[model samples]
Target: MITARYHREIPQRYRLEAGKCKKCGFIAFPHRLVCPKCKSQDFETIRLSDEGKILTFTIVRVASDKFSKQTPFAVGIVELKEGVKLTTQIADVDVDKLEIGQKVKIVFRKIQEDGKAGILCYGYKAVLI
Candidate 1:
């Protein structure tokens, strides 16, 4: 279910669709209305590669208010081959085993919940391949 206030975060969950500027080779993750590199409105929708390299990471000892029960999770920025970097949760890895340049893949997952009566949110998370 969609659980974000911003519409841009929608594609960040279901599909890795992004916008590549026709004027320049700038890829925008979660997509862009205009190219930041060349200020071009002309763009092509591109699906990002599932594979990427972990650029940096951090273990969340103190989780968010929504994800408090899910503490000790890992989060990181991954650099795709398309030159787009995405920040997402790094799952299925020991918190003590995290390091820079770790190879990972984007996977669909449950991110958080609104409440007991609310929607079970979902999004793309990274898993060690």
Candidate 2:
């Protein structure tokens, strides 16, 4: 069964939709009921930019069971052109050559599976530009 949280996050996971606070121009990924900056309740739905630059990164040589098959993957904090920062797996590149400030573009990809016959979860991953 899909949890409400998972259902609620489909927009962010699939389309990178965020909420822009009307009062202070703050963008919240996965949105929020209240603006974290200005404590305002008003917001406007916005789509985040797909392009970004890696601020920092690390090679995950050891990963959990769910991701062990994809070990030695790179994960990074990417700051989108709109200035919203998010942690995402960096894919389709050599981990050793990854550097801070490297340009990347977000893409939809399979994230993981829940069980033997479980649902396949999908989400955004960054690829070198």
Candidate 3:
């Protein structure tokens, strides 16, 4: 059985779906029922931009058990063209050369697996453009 958290994130993880506040034009990633900015309950589903620029980054030398094998990776807060910012792991680049303001594009990739069931979890990762 898929975990609740994983099942809950299917839309955002697979299609990059977000909720846009119909009343105030605020976009919320992961689709919130209530708009944080204007406290509005009305929202429209929207797809986020696939391309973005790195706003800030950090090199992860240590990571949780599920991700330890991929340590020394670069993770960054990317600002999509629509102005939505999301934290994602930067892949397919030299970690030493990563910098803020660098261009990147999101790509679907395997994230990790469920221990005993060997369930493969997939999600988005950013690559230099």
Candidate 4:
């Protein structure tokens, strides 16, 4: 069984869906029920653009248990074209080549597996453009 945390994030993880506040135009990823900027409950579901730029990043030399085998991976906070920023792993490039302000595009990829016989969790990763 998928964890409640993982299950609830399917929309944002799979489709890049976000909640845009109708009152103050604040876009919240993971679809918050309330607007952070204006304290409004009015929102419209919006799909975020896949294209973005790398705002900041870090190389993980030491990783968590789930990501142990993938140590030294590059992760970044990417700012999408629509101004929504999301954290994602940077893929398909060498760590030495990564830089801030680099253009990237989101691609669906396997994020992790639950266990030896567990479910495969898929999510978006940033690919250099």
Per-candidate TM equals 0.91, 0.95, 0.94, 0.95
Residue pairs with colliding backbones in model 4 are none
Per-residue lDDT tens digits of candidate 4, residues 1-93?
Answer: 477878888899999999999999999997888888889999999999999999999999999888999988999999998899999999989
* Per-residue lDDT over 2-73 for candidate 1, one digit per residue giving the tens place of the 0 to 100 score: 545635467756898888888887888767798887899998888899999999999989976888999989
Pick by lDDT: 2 or 3, better one: 2
lDDT of 2 by residue, 1-129 (tens): 275766777899999999999999999987999998999999999999999999999999999988898998999999999999999999999889999989999999988877777777889999999
Pairs clashing within candidate 1: none
Better of 2 and 3 by TM-score: 2
lDDT measured at residue 34 in model 1 versus the true structure, 0 to 100: 83
Error of 1 at 44 (Å): 1.2
Report residue 29 deviation for candidate 4 (angstroms).
Answer: 0.5
TM-score of model 1 (CA atoms): 0.91
TM-score ranking from best to worst? 2, 4, 3, 1
Over all chains combined, what TM-score does candidate 4 have?
0.95
> 3 or 4, which is superior by lDDT?
4
Which run of 10 residues does model 4 get worst, by summed lDDT? 1-10
